[model samples]
Target: MRRLTAAVAASLLPGLMVIAIAGLPVPAGAAEPYDAYADEACDGYFDPLLLERGSRCSGSRERSCPTVRHWTPRRVSRQLPACEGVAQAAHPLHAERIQSSYLALRPDHGAPRAIYLMLHWHRATAHEAVNYLHLQDLARSRGALVIVPDVPGNQWAQSGSRNINQHVAWVDAVLADAQRRYGTGNLPVYLVGLSNGAAMAMHYACARADRIDAVMPVALPMYRSDLAACSFSQSIGYVQVHGDSDRFVPYRGNLWFASAEQVYARMRRNMDCVDAGAKAARLESPLTPVDIRYGDGCVGGRRGYLLRVENAGHTWPDMETLSGRDRNPYGLIARNFDATLQGYDLLQLAAGR
Candidate 1:
């Protein structure tokens, strides 16, 4: 008789009451089922301040009022779990400071064959150098590891800026890091730079010629006074390109910069090139006229090239069309010859690839 009476009472009440009487699992912190349903249901009661609900109940699930939830903070125990075993000392993070910041790119499909250390011009970032030269293309084609490092203050150490030894150390550190991490054992190092960066490359290459394989300096603005400081130990593959109409770093010479011809002559003299074995040619292209002068039969069988672009000025040839914030406002860019392509070609030529 008591069980029948209880069943009849349960049938008259809500389903939640039935669940509570049956002792089924319910969500913790849940309110009384009757009150919760009244709060969550889309009934006729509406508040003007509440923009979410309609004036009247729509009887649609989409228009239904949201259920209110109360969250309580979980308590944390001071004791560690027994399964954690003995506590060990936490290892602290240690950071080593480097001199310069750099951007590096490696080929996706193959092991890198060589390391190309590309230096950027004064007041420019590594990103600009990579974009302006389309260096990724070189990485893809030659399977070369390209690294563009920004000099401190975005300017390479020069006559009066900072200590040149520190800059040299930075370059050494970059090479060491690359070799250590990538296992670039016995791989050739190619130094490529432009303008102020070009001068830096020349300085470092001269200082460490035995380790470097080749160097290509474009629009080099070498100081005449600094010539006495650079003592070339051994000649490597040397290539330079300068615009005849470059006003910034004048083609002939300037008050502060040495003439391109003079610099080329100095390189040849240091390399001990035999003039009789030198070759000269003029190539006419739709973009610009190129005068190529190559000297061979130097000490250690070294080679040097000087490419003079006619009517071009103070710019990396064929970079105007590239997408970047850099603008050649100082001089005109020659579309005829691409310096980036020539750089890779010359590197390959030196490597006998």
Candidate 2:
């Protein structure tokens, strides 16, 4: 039941790793079945060109021709439902869907104070779902809407000029929808991403700082490879989190090169806060109960927080132990951290601007 495995770890790229869990405990209370708007049998739904590549089709295929179908609900349990909800929302938090984009929204319990747009890693619908659920539960408690978009090919950032226009278009649609639904006046908006999604979030934050209040890129690489066009002129806050023992995106440089901390430091320096102070500290959680803290005070005194868990690999921090695979007793760490609270805290810091 342990999620992290040597085989899985070995399959990951230099800056990223994948862990599979047998089963994680679902949240208390009866949860609804994951739903999708797209035809489950449709080929080229998420990746139109994927069909041409002759990838294996797990789901039912209508035509004999090779066609990629929708990733199953169970295969991508965490993301499908939320994406369905967002894409179907009358007033999406951010934007509308592009031709192949998947969008969904988790409505806030009470009047929302702000909106959060979350991006997921490569083909990691289940992780995205779990992360979304944790965030939704937290945001609903605080009255904030959460939006999760399944980017085409899971590319949230405009790396090459290839799909850049399409990516921006989708974001524009979602943001426009969010503004129409939730008055943009003073409602703070935040962008968060994990792994590849983190890269996308950083790309967006740098390029379109006007749209987001803060950016959190988790478990991304250090070199900032394939992401040079991202703009950093705007004054958007950033929080970078990574594990010290992460084999995927290691603390030290890896075979693929540049570490995540290095990338974050470069971004922080670009923001004109290179001389900020650093504080090493520890955080104790009921689950993992480990000592960890970040090198505080990055750009603008916003200090980057890196939670180094000894022997911990690439996985969401502070997550409740659902399976034996998750060694850290503390549940998803990010889940426990109230993003709304984080948003307000960042807003206070940005208020001086």
Candidate 3:
């Protein structure tokens, strides 16, 4: 497993610069992906061209030329089985279904203190479960139960009003079932999501604050629709992880030309914590320069932490191995970055808050 340093992470920014150069014109009638309240023409804040090129681009220059036709949702859905297979292999402890599954791991000693509700990226189910397991193992070591449920249709962000409400209902069912089985008061519940799933987690936090004590959204897009109804106060402790070189979610900013920092700033404003102070810290990583910015500039006493990986793409920070050829850069990055450590940090923040 190759580790990325800050210098390495910084080097990846040029790729984004190139994507920005090849920018696409915003579609006139594009429906916002998440919130239905937004204007239909407001095609998210992130650049679809950059995301498509960066995420799907591959091979040598001649071999990597853009396809003549655009991708359709149906086409993407056809690729879901591969991702689901990966998830199943990664977390054998978890029970699988057509749309979702559950992974259970018990601690070596005492009862768990918290239960993590892990969400997968678009078109990716248990295939990405290994990454979730890495965190689950750490949680188990610390006496925490990890619950990962697969969202049917591989939908994370509310694609529409119906999907949003359906997701909310599913979440409610899961929580209710968990409570009935394990006595809700015994363990704190936390939510974590990656990529579009991150956006979904934000939506969940906003709509179901009582169910989540904290949330960590990684490599997320900055879509106005996603944040349209989001009230920051509901997100008691928010930890966002992003890579500066992420082509899917560029560090330079979104199609709206807003940087991730700016997006968080907007979120802080919405949460009524606009005056919170931000402090910077470094994270342990084998690859890329990882820095964490935290403090109370956004929501009064409440705090937010942003993990920025320099020169990194759309991947997790510290994983041991790359799962597939098409794995998100940030997910690959997670091999080196410890989600367990992140989970613990969330626990601490939740305790303090």
Score candidate 3 by TM-score against the native: 0.63
Write down the TM-score for model 2.
0.62
Q: What is the lDDT, from 0 to 100, of the residue 43 in candidate 2? A: 28
Q: What TM-scores do the predictions have?
A: 0.68, 0.62, 0.63
Model 3, residue 282: displacement in angstroms? 2.5
lDDT of each: 0.59, 0.46, 0.50
Which is better, 1 or 3, measured by lDDT? 1
**Over the stretch 1-353, how does candidate 2's per-residue lDDT look in tens digits?**
12223223322322112232443443456355322112343222212122234432112211121111234334434332342112224232334345443343444333565667777665654234333225544343334466666555544543444665557667667666666655654677777666666656666676677777667665664334543444567555666666566666675656453665566566556555555455444332222222323333434444344444444455554332323244332113332222233332333343222
Error at 326, model 2, angstroms: 1.5
What is the C-alpha lDDT profile of model 1 across 281-321, one tens digit per residue? 65443334667777577776667778898876666765522
lDDT tens per residue, model 3, 1-353: 11223213322211111111111233366454222122222121111122233321111111111121233323322222222111221132222223344544445455666767777666554334434225434443445565666666655534344567667666666656555555645566778876666767777877776666677777666454555556744546667778787765677664432467876665556545555355665533334546666666433355666667766667554332322221333322433244444444543463334
User: What ranking emerges by lDDT with the best candidate at the front?
Assistant: 1, 3, 2
Clash tally for model 2:
35
CA displacement after TM-score superposition, residue 234 of candidate 2 (Å): 2.0
Question: How far in Å is the alpha carbon of 174 misplaced in model 2?
Answer: 1.6
Instruction: Point out the higher-scoring one by TM-score: 2 or 3.
Output: 3
